[model samples]
Target: MMVNCCGLLTSQKEPVPLKSVEVELEVRDHVATVVSTLSYENKEDKPLEAVFVFPLPGDAAVCHFSAQIGQMQIVAEVKEKQEAREEYDDALSSGQQAFLLEESEQSPDIFSLSVGSLPPGESASIRLEYVTELAVQADDGLRFCLPAVLNPRYQPQGSGGGEGGNVQVTSVQVTSVPASLVPYSLSFSARVSSPRPVSKVESNCPLDPLQYLNTEQTQTTVKLAAGHKFDRDVELLIYYKDAHQPTAVVEAGRASSEPGTLMGDPVMMLSLYPEFPQAVMSSVASCGEFVFLLDRSGSMQGARMKSAMDTLLLLLKSLPMGCYFNIHSFGSSYEHIFPESVEYNQKTMEEALKNVAEMKANLGGTEILKPLKHIYSQPCIPSQPRQLFVFTDGEVGNTKDVINLVKQNSGSHRCFSFGIGEGASSALINGLAKEGGGHAQFITGTDRMQPKVMQSLRFALQPAVQDISVKWDLPKGVSVIDLSPPITALFQGQRSLVYAQLTGQGSEASEGCVTVRYSLAGHPSQNQLHFSLKPAEDTGLTVHRLAARTLIRSLEMEKREWRGQEDGGDKKKKVVELSVQSGVSSAFTAFIAVNKGNSEVIQGPLVRRNVPTPMVMACGMRRQCVPMSYDASPVMNMMALRQAEPCSLKKRSLPKQPPRDPLLQLVSLQKASGCWVLDPDLAAALGKTSEEVEKPKPASVNQEVWATILALIWLHGFKMDAQEEWELLAMKAVSWLQAQKASCVTECVDAGNALLGCTVQKDVLGL
Candidate 1:
């Protein structure tokens, strides 16, 4: 979640310093370089100071920060956090123009910026640049998000608060305000180039038609519509002809920097897409211990609660019969469906489904750590690997603590996490998956959770990739120093990135090969890529900055693990040194810029102003925005952001009927064994009467077998596009039909396909 907003301004009519923002996005392959420029004007009588806080992607490496006042410009320098703060204070006291930016001590995703000693009637421009890799969506699209999380985090007492106990988050009360009401102007543009052909681009926000630069369709440009306001999150999903191709980019280092340093040498980024054998992929595992953790916090009141329940129903119905499973929900406290995980059977599944239906968002606040700790404490079932599925809106205050706990127990279990709703913490969601040897997915803005959830479940069922190692083979006199941590998990078609330093000297025409070796389900295999060592032309220091950020994060995690030990200090020093050398902002570093051009020191008492930002949102296009009103100011102090409690009368619980969804209706009729019996509900789901479906059944086929085949055929015919959501359950049904060993299986399939008006073949339905 990354949002830029001011706190508040005195006299709403008074002009504020911050006026407008313009952003440029340059995407080269999977990496993105973003540049944002903000224009501010001080219209007050005396010299004043302004402070603003905002959110950023947790993994982004902020590489540049600068400010321009009139004709003079100052480029900020990255320095130790304490030293930068002291310099900022000294410059402010001396009445010199200064700017300071630093990450929160507790939350990496939040930062504060202060502008000091700005003279009256002066205009200034601030520029910030960063680089980050895009996340790969389940459908193979590359996802880039300009995230806007207006909702303040929800936290309870002692729910993962950090050592820096003073946490403050500003919230403004309003519904969906119109974009025109916002004071600031915004413009966004993007240029995308890829090795593969650019198929298309889609976004949650409206964009001008994509313009291709060449006939090959490898390069293109797109921009936001003229009427777009910087209110809601802006997301872009880019697709390519072959998205799974592996790539390697080698970038040259800065000339002025000394050799043998992170900045002065060549850096290589390897993008590896693992390939799994089809024999293993075709079979879904039926044995595992599946545990689900859900967030029942008060913030998850309406739509979120409904989606969460719908996803749980799909999960419960799709589980393999021999597996063990349990359901856990948490708020300020936690509760479980059973004392421990119970075997997955008809009775247990029914009981779990019934309890799931009754669950609500009435649980007080977000406290996920307790439930996670409890789950990890439970004994792992022998021969049944533990797969933990965690779902939340990601509002916890102790994100680092929770992530560390996941890493500690990562050896025994795999964690699949889902960040539900807008404003979910990317840090918490990505951190849990990265540490627990599983995958993470974010569901937001009309995105269906069931598909993404089922995809992750498939990853969980895939045989684990173990004993992974990366080996680099370069020319003589060239050695490599790996920057990324060791690979712990891999899923078929998922991209894994590796960064390394190219040390020593090599000919410009030298070619190098890198091999990735891993064992999947006891079969040892390897993937190799050979590429030229020549430094890429016109490729800036984006790769180096990202590499530095990765190393810094790995070291920070190590520092946390080595806390109170002598090695921790060394790791901290290394992080600060590398951060300064690479000109990137880290938790231990801050960016500071100062101006001493004004020789006169005739400043009086300086007034401080906090600008207020109203959050006006528009969904898909420029012509439409949510009609409600909202005031979302994003100046944060790494504390829990709870919606200010509204005193209301306690409401009585009502037994409401579940809505009749065609998909869920069909899904619910499938038994635990994955066979559908002939019933009126099943017929209704398939849009036919029970007698009509029963009359055409083959003489050799029983009612159960015919109904099961009909369900499979209907899913293939009507819901083919949503295969990701129902693929697992459909596979189970196919397995059950095979187990029956009916002689007329093909006859039943052909008849069912004709009845459903589907041309699907027996093989396609897995009959």
Candidate 2:
């Protein structure tokens, strides 16, 4: 047995020493290319092998890996995973230096790297390179995260056992220590280039001041601050000016390949920002079945759970009177607010609000699969489209399985997903929305939940775009081969990227045009884009690689959909061939390196060591606790009850304050027109900022009606317990609302209820 510096394992032998690490990242537009170099030295007298388990972004596609032994550099080659493993084992047994890397079948975020048979006192340097798309935050800032912490995922009872039931329930060991105690040193730097001006760069970790490389402010460089330990995940948020503009880039293909092939042809990437007509925006359906699947796992404790509750309150209040709704909270198991979805009347809305307030993260572990299966098993109401809103910390291990299930049920409903907190799994959050044809939003740091949640609700309420088609008009000799799959969904003010291979190049002076045609709210609409045919300068194959990646993903998705059939084998083989040809690593192919110099067959028993990762300190848990484990027994009920005690204590320890009169507050906060402006002062009183309050507004809301509705909601929602004290002020607000004809009172009330989680009566307001 082998151990790591964190002391996560009990081993009889000494642990190997890991030296320093260097990281380099290049971010262009919304994609990131990362390279990491790890150095290791073996101080033992005998030859030794080192195995290191590490974390990576779940969606990253590893492109290159190589190892340096002494003065020899051996580059890796992509091959079938099992074949690569066999070759690596044979090389190690023959006393040749070899390196092997494989992603965990249990978790895509975890990877194991083996440096085998290093002679005593010899040092080996390993380099890895990967590319991943950066997710856009709700604020339109691009988010890039380097994961340094790996929290152990607990498998639920009766679930498929870990590693086929032979391995320990918790296969990976996680240890937590103070930042200063970490032995590893990290050096990271990034060069960012985008079409839009770089507004600013922010990070959770300390960073040096950003340096602009050009006068245009479109290119910049940033590095970590001095004395940064490899502790928490390194997160960078990059903001760009004019972020929503549509653009296109034409890239010259590889000069070394045949002209007819995909790599040898020119490629074009088009970014389309569709702007729906105002008439279409105002035509959203008022009735639908809204199902909420909330994660109540231990990881979602504290601020995450609070945010979910706030979001749920807004959703409950926003539902139309005739819409059907239900709420399901899940961890190890799930509990529903009602046996079936009920119409969103005053009674049901109030009941949901009360139950939502009591929802907690007392659930044991994140076991979302069963709850999702259950939700899909229920029948959807006719004429009312089903919209599923999932709020989670996104710590599930079976991400692919979950996404597959959602895809299988995509026809029945659309899924809008919210990823809460830092280091949430992008694979799960983004995959769910992508497969289910909906939008994805992430909430982190001090970001408010109202705007993002309400934006998704609006999307859900909008009628789906239909009859999508693309038509291209190019100069003579110019042909297009579509690289991306057909567009499945579109939303107003949202950007969609289409990539195509432009073969049989046209004249440099010629121009090409493309039009996207679709129907929104039963009205036919089309967007036309025109661009020069000239190839852009110095693109450096970024567009080509991205196009390849997109095609690979589409093919892989098809394979997953057709899995277990005869065609699955053909699809799998095609994916491997394409991956190898493009030098892109896939789920079926691995990069392997071997150093065959001085191949003397003298070797002892090779030691297999598992490196320990830093445990993520989450959910108010202390650092001294062991890594979380789940047993295949029915003890979760007791565990959940025990967990609730600490939560109750935490709640009780907060200092108590006398409740303020909400009606008096509302009256004091009202403007001169008997309306609330949702300005900074009023926003502060409502525990929000002016920016948050003003961000997400439906097209149908009128300022006057909205302000009056908010004022009335403030009085009704908070002062109901002391109605006698504020009855006069509430009546005045209701009268003001009744007098307003400038806006549709019904729409304003619905918007206010959705935002404030209040069920103010329209009839009482005489609207």
Candidate 3:
């Protein structure tokens, strides 16, 4: 998780720069040219000083452009325009162009400047105009940054005119560029510099993969013979030392063909791992008090909203018997569905879920931090495990303020945050969680939220091991260290994970026991658990921060590479440390490297299992994401496919590329037909029937026609009765097609017509 370590500042104040990135690229006649434009909008309550900096490529053969900022006089730069050799179309029109002005059929370039930084409620627009020669190529070669500065600040513009100083820009846009010239990289960052520093800063961690694994049922294993691939799920044990109880994590699973044997189709597979110490289950417990902050924002209108609701329903249904909970939802406005924290009675819970279902999302502004402050100020119910769970897609009105608020209010209450979807603010969620002494979790897509919600709810209900804290035992010369927050509240017997970083040249590893102090609900004194960290042979400062730093740097560099090609060369840049960092850690770093490209194509054990298949296609939009098992469960496969490609069903067949597996289709059809059933006629035709010579029955009327051709061939023994067979096949085919509403889906009608036309017209009608 990337974080701006500074304390929260008021939105009314100016923002200071915390970091700067610049990108450089070679320019040539053959290289992609920079086609740029700028548009400005003032939507805020202040006049924002906008400065757009588009740096030139290092090896530019030529560069030319006209620039302007509204009606104000501004300095503009002009470079030599590259020579063009294409035949000029003088007769096309008076505006006959020399360069090829090919327009893309889709995804044309556009620059929009909406009103921004108007007085409290007003709005205004800033104009922009620019043009450059077309350097046709597959790749882009220019760079730019929105607010290109190191220490940026802004002030609210009053009715009086103020001194017009150097304007600093924070964002950029492209114009007159081909769709194919789109770059494959992009980076985004916002930092708070020179701010009021109250306390802590945080780093956001990627969501735990185990949270996506479905675990509602007992672990089931299926054995596969050689040459078989089976999709499935398995339970993983989440254990920590000195915790009350161990937690179980489920994983969606799959096993491909193992080594030898004739590979016809994938069948089944399973595994048995070495078991750890026997886990002791703890008594059922419930939190003292809880608040569920849900987002009912506009962007979460369809599938995402459905998934969120469904997951909420599941949690409501499974809440502990005596737990107390509150329901809070926000979008343009905030609503406490339950006026106050209420007991977990069946009626109240049902009413809450119903309210969520009936909710009409009033999508507009996102006022995140304000509502939390209100909730925090309310009097708490004493003696209960007091906590708040902020559930959102992580968009915020002001991130820094929200983080600071959570941190300040977290002394007596724990705040756990769950990011619902891709647009969620990682930094905000992480900060809220860290400040509230809770773990922050991110759900990438709607379908992934259910399992995570279930696991989190279960954990929240478990007895806490007590408040956990961490302090660095700094070695000599180690200064200016940056440390991640301490993870608190382990299960009664579980261990906590706490890490810290120290800056400096030299520091020897020291032997010391890190003490974890916590207390059970109703317990007397705090219990102190100690874990010894004997400086392993590997105690290098760089070694410890390798994983964390690499992930950050790789993402940073990727953004620069992206800007180089997108906004037309050298407008933005980053150091190569990013790529090096991506090569380090085995886990987190791997995510950074792969996240830069298409996730599906960069396959891995986890990636393969998560890739959308036919199963996902059939699930439709989830009301709430539920933990999913990828095993050979026909229902699950259908559900996966439904959610992933709801529209893919319109297509008759899956992609024909042989490299693309046909198994997904087969599995889809199998599930659609209600699982495997004996094909009696095929068995009879093979003379391998087991006293059951059943006639061919189509899975549906559509498939029944497909069976008719085979039945006719069998009846006439493939000879003299060919015409009769043709007539029968045609009759059945047309009838089945009609019943199946063939015309509704073109594929069914087309297939039916082709088959009947082939047999009836050629043999029976002789036309």
Candidate 1, which ten residues in sequence have the lowest lDDT sum?
618-627
Name model 2 segments beyond 4 Å from true. Answer: 1-16, 104-109, 154-182, 282-285, 445-447, 598-602, 628-767
RMSD of candidate 3 to true structure, Å:
26.2
Please list the residue runs of candidate 3 whose C-alpha ends up more than 4 Å from where it truly belongs after superposition.
1-182, 185-281, 467-488, 491-510, 522-767
Please give the RMSD to the true structure for each candidate, in Å.
5.2, 8.2, 26.2
What range of 10 consecutive residues in model 3 has the weakest lDDT sum?
606-615
lDDT of each: 0.80, 0.72, 0.34
Report the lDDT tens digits of candidate 1 across residue range 238-281.
Answer: 99998999888899999998888989999999999988889988
**lDDT measured at residue 87 in model 2 versus the true structure, 0 to 100:** 98
Clash number for each model: 13, 0, 71
Tens digits of lDDT, candidate 2, 481-521 = 99987877788776778999998867888999999999887
Q: Which candidate is the best by TM-score?
A: 1
TM-score list, all predictions: 0.90, 0.81, 0.38
